[model samples]
Target: MSDAIEWVAVDWGTSNLRAWGMSVAGAPISSATSDKGMGKLERGQYPQALQDVVRELGVEDGRHLDVLVCGMAGARQGWIEAPYLEAPTDLRGLAQSSVRPDVPGSTLSVSILPGVCQKRGGENVMRGEETQLLGLASTQQGYEGLVCMPGTHSKWAYLRDTHIGQFSTAMTGEVFEVLRTHSVLRHSLTGENDGAARDAGFGTGASDGLARPQDLLGQLFRVRAASLLSGRDSSWCAGYLSGLLIGTEVAAHLDDIGEAAVPLIGSTSLCALYATVLSMAGKDGRPVDATSVAIAGLSAARQQLA
Candidate 1:
C-alpha cells in the first residue's frame, strides 16, 4: 500500500452501510454512510454503490485503494459471500479468509472479513459485530471475558486472547419489536419514550419480570391484561416489554457467563437497557463506546496491511 493512497474501512450491515476513508496511518480523513444496506440493494448494484462513495471522496484511479469490510456485506446477500470462520479464530485467521469484491475493470484492492460462526448445540452466526469485538479486544490487555453487543439481535461472545472462543445470539431486540407492534400488549404502550419514565419502567419491570424466566411469556401478556383489569398505567408498557425481553435474554445466558462481568458494546440506549437488565439479574455490565471501537478495529486491520 502506498503512503499516499487511501484505505477504506467498511462496516456494512443489513440496514446500514458505513465507510471511512483514511490515511495509511488509519486516521479517518472522511466517512460516509447510507440506508443502502445489504437488505435494500439489488444484486448488481454492489460495485456502483461502493463506487458512489469512492467517487464522492474523489478517490482517483492508479492509486491503490485497500479496503477491509465487515458486517452483513459478508453475508450471502451482501456484496460478496465471505465464508464463516468457526470460533477461536483471530484477526490473522479472519484476514486469511477475506474475500475480494469482483469489481470488473477496476483495480481497487479489497478484502472482506469472514463472519464468525459456530455450532455448539445449534448453528450461530455473526457478521459485522465480530470485527468490533476484535477491535475492542485488540486494544485492551488480557482481554479474556465475555463481550455483549446489544442490538436488533443481541450477541454474547466469549473471547480468550485475540481469538473468539465461543458465542451465542439472542433475538431479544427482534422479539421486543414484534411484541410491541404485533402482540396484544401493543395497546398498553404509550409509544416509545427517551426519558426517565422509560428508564424507570425498564429498571423496575426488568428487575421484577426478569426474576421469573419460566413465567416470562405469561407475564408478558399480563402487561396487557393488568392494564385492563387492575388499571396499570399504559405509559410503562414500553419499559415492561423492554424488561421482559432483556430479562429473558439474561436468564437464558447468565448460567453460562460464570464470574466474568461482560462489557456491553453498542448504542448508549441499548447499553443502558442491557446494563439495567443485567443489574436486575444481580450482575453488573459496563458500556464500551461502539463507534470508538469501530474506528480502533479498522485501525488494527490496517496495521496488518503494513
Candidate 2:
C-alpha cells in the first residue's frame, strides 16, 4: 500500500463537483471543486472534468486514484446510471448499488453511489442527500430519531438504529423560490431575508401555517395584501413566506417526529430556519455540518471496498 495518499471522495451534485483526497487513515489531505457538475457537463465530458480537478489538487502522478463519488453523477442523466435503492435500506447499502464508470486516460477510477427512492404514497427521489444521510448514520451510532435535510427540496428521513427506514421530500424551499420570484408575492418580497425579518415575520407566518395548514393558499396571498394594505415591507413578506412553507412542512411531520428533537443536516441559514420553526413548536433542531458528514459518509463507503 502506498503511504503517500489513500483514496479520493467526490460529491457530484447538479450544481457543483466537490472532491476530497484522504489518507488511508480517513483524514482529508487535500480538496478540490469545480463548477462542472452533472448538470453542467455532457455525459462524455465527465472524465476530463474530474481529471482536471484531481490534477489541480496535486494528486500523486501516474497513480490510479480510487475515487468514490456520491450524488447526481450517478443519476440516469449523469455519466452513468446507478439505480435507486428503495426505502428501509441499510445506509451502507448504497455502495452495493454503486456503479463504476470507465474513464479512459484519467488518473482516477470512479465509483458513484446510488440514490434512494420512495414510491409509496406519492413518488419521491433523493440523490446527493442520501450520501449525507449515510454520513449521518456513520457517525451517529445508537441514534434513533428523525433527520431533516432542508434545501431546495428538504428531506425528512426516519433513522431506526442508524438505518434509513423511510423518507419523504418537501418542496418547501422550491415553493418559496417560485412564489418569491415569479408570483404576485414577489411584489411584497424585497429579496431580503435577514435575521431581523426572519424574527419579525417567520414566527407569525409559521404560527398561522401550524394552526391552519388548509389555509395556506389564503395565507400566501395575504403576503401581498399585507404589503399593500398594512404597509408591510418586502423583507417581512419574504421571511413570512419562507416561514409559512417551512411551517406547513413541519406541521405535517410534527406528529411523526415524536418526543425527540430532529437532527438537521443542511446549510446554516436553512438549518437556522428549521431550528426556529421546531423551537417555536416545542421541539428542537440539531445542526450537523453537511460537508463533514458527506466526507464521513464517503469514508464509510470506502471502507466497504476493503
Candidate 3:
C-alpha cells in the first residue's frame, strides 16, 4: 500500500496531528494520527513527530514523499510560519500561497498551507478550518452559504461564490470548559448528565439565551442560583450551560442565517448539538463530515502542487 501512495495529506492542529496517505487519484489509501501536535512540540521536534506519523502510514525510509500540511503546524510558533491569506480570498489556489519548510534529515517534502484572515470588519484568523472550507467548496462546486465549524473555538464563515468573504468566531466550547472547571459554577455542574433532565434543562436554557443574548452576563449566575434554590443536579446545570452558550452564539448569527440550511462542518456530536439549536429557531443545520472535507480540501491543494 505504501508503494501506491502518491503523497501524504496532514491536518496538524494544536492538540492532534492527523495524516492520510493519498493515492494517485487523490483518495486516501491509508491513515494515521498522533497526540504530538504543534502545542506539544518544540520547533526542532516537528520533523521527528511528522516523520513518526508518516512512517506509520507505511512510507519507507529514504523514500521521497510529498506531504501537504494544513493547520497550526504552519503557525509562527509551529514548524515554520505560513502567513495568513486575507479574506475576501478565494479558497482555490491555496497551494499557490503555501510555504515549503526545510525538514532536515527527513525524506518528507512538506508544504504548509496558509491560513485565512479577516481584516476589515474584525481582526480574525483561521488555520485548518480554511482547508476544510476549501474542501466544502470542492465538494459543492460554486457553493455559497454560511458555514459553522464547531469545536473549542467555533467558527462561522461566509462562502461567497467559493471565496471566503467574511467570518466570525465564538469561543463557545473553550469558555464552557473553563467555566465548568475553574469557576464557582463548577460546584453546581460536577456530575454526569442525566438524559431527560439534561434535555429539559438545555431547552429552557437555550430559550433564555436566544431570547436575551444581551443579558448573557446576567444569566450565568442564574445557573448557580437555580441549583442552590431548587437543588438542580449537575446534569441539568451542565446541559443548561452548554445550551446557553451555543444559543447565544446562534443568536448573534441569526441575521445571517435567515431561513438558510447551514452547513455544520465539524465532529458529528458537536454538529448535532448545533443542529438541535438551529432546529429550535426553525432553521436547518446540515452536518458535513470534517475529516472527509479536510481530506478533500487537502486533495484540492495537492492537485495544484502536482
Candidate 4:
C-alpha cells in the first residue's frame, strides 16, 4: 500500500485532522483521521500527531512521502503559519506560495498551503476553505460566481474567473451554538430538529429573518418568548434559531448573490439547510461536495511539487 501511495493530502482544521493517501493518478486509496486537530495540538506536537495519522494510512517506515496540507494547520498558532495570500489572488497557484515546514527527523516532506485574506471592507481571513474553492475552480473551468461555505465560521466568496475577488465571514454557527447552550434561549431549545413542526418553524424564522434582518437581535429573544407563551417545543426552537441565523447570513449577501445560483459547500446537512434558506429567498442553491473539492484542491497542489 505504501509503495502504491504517491503522496498524501491533508485537511487539518480546528477540531479535526483528515488525511488521504493518494495514488499517482490523483485518486485517494486510503484515508485516516484524528482528533488531534490544530486546536488540540501544541506547535511542537504537530509533527508527531501528523506522523501517527500517516502511519495509519499505511505509509511504510522510513518511506518518504510528500504531504500537502490545507486549513488551520497553517494558522499562526498552528503547526507553521502559512502567510495569507491577499484577495484578487488566483486559486490555481496556491502551491507556488505554499510553505515547506522543516520537520527534523521526520521522513515526511510536508508543505502547508497558504490561505486567502481580504483587507478591503473590514479585514477577513480564511484557512482551510480556500482549498475547497480551488477544487471547485479546478473542476469547473473558468467558473465565476458566489459560493457559500457554511460551518462554524461561514464564508461567502466571489470567484471571478477562478480568482477570489472578495470574501466575508459570518459567525452564524458558533453564535447559534453559544446561544443554544449558554443563553436564556437554551431553555427553549432541545437540539431536536427532525419533523414537520421543525421544518415549519424553520420556514417561519427564515421568512422573518429575510424580511427584517436588521431586527435579528430583537427577534432572537422571540424564541424563548414563543416557547413560554405559545408552548412551542424544543425542536421548533432549535429549527427556528438555525433558520433565523442562516437566513440573516443569506440576507446580508443577497446583493452579492443577485439572481444567480449560489454554490453551497460544506457538510451535506448544513448545505441542505442553506439550500432551504436560499430557496425561501426565491434563489437556487446548488450543493457541492466539500470533501471532493478539498481533495481536488490538494491534488492540484501536489502536482506543483512535480
By lDDT, the candidates rank as: 3, 4, 2, 1
TM-score of 2: 0.95
Which lDDT value does model 2 have at 281?
A: 89
lDDT of 4 by residue, 5-62 (tens): 9999999999999999999999999999999989899899999998999999999767
Which residue ranges in model 2 land beyond 4 Å of their true spot? 1-3, 191-195
- What is the C-alpha lDDT profile of model 1 across 1-306, one tens digit per residue? 224436888888888788878775667777788777899998788777777766555576556677788888889878789999887678547677788878786667778888988877568999877788778877775778788999888898888767887788888889888887888788887554556666666766677666787777677886787678866566666776787778878887788665667788999988987887787677888899987778777677667656
Candidates ranked, most accurate by TM-score first: 3, 4, 2, 1
In every candidate, how many clashes are there? 1, 0, 0, 1
* Strongest candidate by TM-score: 3
Model 3 C-alpha lDDT per residue in residues 159-222, reported as the tens digit of each score: 9655898898899999999999999999999887699988888888888889899998899887
Show where candidate 4 strays beyond 4 Å.
Answer: 191-194
Q: Which stretches of candidate 1 lie over 4 Å from their true place?
A: 1-5, 58-62, 191-196, 258-260
Q: lDDT tens string, model 2, 1-306?
A: 234568888999999999888887897888898999888889999988888777766775678789999999999999999999988788778887889999877767789899988888657889988888878888877778789999998999988754777788888888998887799887788755566865788888998888888788888987988888998887788778888888988998888786777889999988988999999888988999999999999998888766
Worst 10 residues of 2 by lDDT: 1-10
| Model 1 residue pairs with clashes | 71-128
Per lDDT, the best of the predicted structures is 3
Give the clashing pairs for model 3: none
Error of 3 at 82 (Å): 0.4
